[model samples]
Target: MKLNRLELDFFRNYSHVEATFHPRVNLIYGDNAQGKTNLLEAIAYLSSARSHRARYDRELIMLNEPQGYIKGEVDSRERTFILEAKLNRGKTRQLWSNGLRLKTAGELAGILTTVLFCPEDLYLIREGASARRRFLDGAICQLRPRYAQALAEYNRLYEHKTRILRDWQENPSLLDTLDDFNLRMAQFGARIIHYRAHFVRRLGEQAPAIHADFSGGREQLGLRYETVSTVQDPLGSVQDIFESLLKHQESHRRAELDSRQCLSGPHKDDLVVELDGQSAKQFGSQGQTRTAALSLKLAQREIFQQETGEWPVLLLDDVLSELDGKRQSFVLNRIQGGQVFITCCEPEKLDGLERGKSFQIQGGTILSQRSV
Candidate 1:
């Protein structure tokens, strides 16, 4: 899929702006904090109906603005679609596709798939387990709407269970409902664990070869999905996982009550990365970690393409400058046959790339456009 045009109003720093995009590579160049990342964020928001950088819709609106808007013309599955989103300060965001209102944000999942690579992602290897889990959730949510619904249900159950645990001491009556919440959490958490395990398995199959090639066959990469010990097989059936979660939850009931925390479920799951049989998070050097992260992202893109039969739009937010020439070349060479938007401070960094369109953005406005 590709974005043909984008129109933004009161979104981020862009007050009123519209720009067309090339189906191939499009370079967006600007200095830091000059709206380069903001523009990319808008496009990413269109794909997922949520901002990667902001937790609230109010944060996306311009200063003193009551509301914001983002509209895009997307080409997917041999047809054109008009996707629009309206952001309000104190209300729910509205979303529409092809002039029809969508009931839920998950409805926009498969319409436009995007893979974003930002500077923060370069440190994904050493980041906390939440970040890694987010990586898994974001990618899977876009590809499988069922996973998104299951995740939402699991998180909601987790929150209710935690609140009951936290307040049960004050009101013993709350304990009466804990078992019901625990049962529902197990049902949803089992589905989440199943999906994540399958995704990680596929990622493991695809990422190791890419990492070996990126490292010139000097390094071997591996991925393992870590969940509660009761789960004998992550790839097992839903019933098996549900039983396992129940067993683990029962075992941790006393400890959970003592700590007043929800400590046994998919919420604490992790994706472990190994380089040459050692933990990448604990032992990999800076370069090795970066390469591992890149391989993982590229593998994600490939997995999307394999499942959907088309390449997802690639968004690189000033990530090339963080990589050396060899690694940059490796990434650029691997991203063919798809639409790409790359933001960079130095235009010379793209000098060796093939011809494409280039835009100069300044102060949330498009200054000029030229063929690169």
Candidate 2:
């Protein structure tokens, strides 16, 4: 899927802006805090109904504005779809596709898939499990709408179960409800885990050569899905893991009550990034960590293309400036002929980037008609 044009109003730094994009390679260059990231965030929000930066609806609105608006035209499945998002004060964000109101985020899924590579993504290996989990969940959700729904259900079940446990002393009856919740929780949680395992397995198959290429063939890389219940028996169905979850709920909750949280299932799962048979988190250098993160994201894009029959729009948010020439060349080689939206402070920092459509961003304004 490729975005043809984008319009935004009252979103972060952009009060009002509209720009058309080339199907392959578009660059937005500006100094810091000049709305480059905000523009990309608006595009991402229009596509996914959420922001990769984790900005809340209220936070996304301009400081003095009561609402935020985003509109985009995308080429998907051989037809153009106009995707729109409206964020009003004290109301849920509203979404529309080609003038039809979308009832759920699932309706908006696959309309425009994007793999964002930002400087912060370099933390995927060294950060806590939440980052890696989000990486896996977000990528898989875009490919499988049902997986997203199942993950949402599992999280809801986890919250409800936690509430009951927190008030257990005063609400003994909630335990029975918790019992019922755990059963469904396990069922949905098992499905999410299964999808993630399958996703990571595919990543393992696709990421090795990518890692080698990105690392100049000096490093061997692998991705492993680390879950308590997902892989105990690969040949078995999620039902088996759910059965195991149901049986262990009592003991797990008894211990977790002391900590006031759900202690088991997909919520606690992690992705183990390995380099040369050692944990990257523990052994990889800063450059290696970033390389691994880049490999994983590129692999995700290719896998997404294979699964969906279309390339995901690529977003590179100031990620290339830090790479050495060799790695930058490798990165450039991979993104040559795709729809890419990039942001950088200095235009000269990007090699062979000025040849593409260029925009100068300053003071929340996009100067789009000029090349320099």
Candidate 3:
């Protein structure tokens, strides 16, 4: 998958900008807050229909603008297609692919997948379980439509159940339907766990090898999917897992009520990472964590290619600058065979990369486009 062309209007700081892209490597360089990352975000959004930075669609629009637009002419599976997203402040947002309306963001999955490694991702190994879960969700949602649907439904049920748990004392009527919510949530949660288990298994195959090479065989990375204990086998059938989920939910029901929180689902799942048989979250150093995180992302990209038979676009958003010379070289070496966008504060940061187009961005506009 590749984004051949992009156009932005009233999005972020860009009033209007259009540019063609290099399929191999496109470098975006500029000073801070000059929209380099914004351009990458626009391309990434076409696949996931989400901004990695912004929580709300309206925040992606320019100040005082009624709407913002992002359009990409993409090449996927050797065919050309147009993806469009319109963000409105007061009204609903719209997504379209090749002129037909897309009902949900999940519809955009798998068409143009992206493996994004940003500065914040450097802390993945040490961050809490929620961040690792997001790592799984972001990658899986783009690759599996069924997993995406299950996750969305499970999230909705979680929200509903949380409100019920939090307010049942004041409004006892909310308790009337809690059992129904639990059953349905277990159904979806089971599916999500099944998918996550399989995906993390794939990661297990790739990430450790990559990390071993990255660490010069000094560290052996290990991965295991961690979920509620009652669900003994995450890879089991949906019915079996669903029953286990319901059982676990019952076990935690009283604890949840006491704490007034929803804490009894796959929503609390984690990807346990170990380095040399030690918990990476607790023992990994800064450099080790960042390298492990990079390995995980590159492994994710490899998994995407293996599943889809094509390379997903890779976006390295200011992550190269965070790495030391050797680690940066490691990332640059592994990122070939696919379209890549690298953002940095200056063009010199991309000195080792050869043969690509470089865009100088300033004030949300492309100041220049030149071959590097």
Alpha-carbon RMSD to native, per candidate: 1.1, 1.9, 1.0
Model 1 gets an lDDT of: 0.94
Clashing pairs for predicted structure model 2, backbone only = none
Q: Per-residue CA lDDT of candidate 1, range 157-210, in tens? A: 888999999999999999999999999999999999999999999999999999
Native-vs-model 3 lDDT? 0.91
- Candidate scoring better on lDDT of 1 and 3: 1
Tens-digit per-residue lDDT, 1-372, candidate 3: 788999999999999999999989999999999998889888888998877888789999999999999999988977888999999998889999999999888898889999998999999888899899999999999988888888989888999999999999999898899999999999999999999999999999999999999989999999999999998999889899999999998998899888999888898899999888899889988888888898899999999999888999999999988888999899988987989999999778677787899999999989999888
For model 2, residues 270-323, the per-residue Cα lDDT tens digits are 999999999999999998998899899999988978887888899989888877
- Badly placed stretches (over 4 Å) of model 3 are none
Better of 2 and 3 by TM-score: 3
Scored against the true structure, residue 336 in model 1 reaches a CA lDDT of 88
lDDT of each: 0.94, 0.83, 0.91
Worst 10 residues of 3 by lDDT: 346-355
Clashing pairs in 3: none
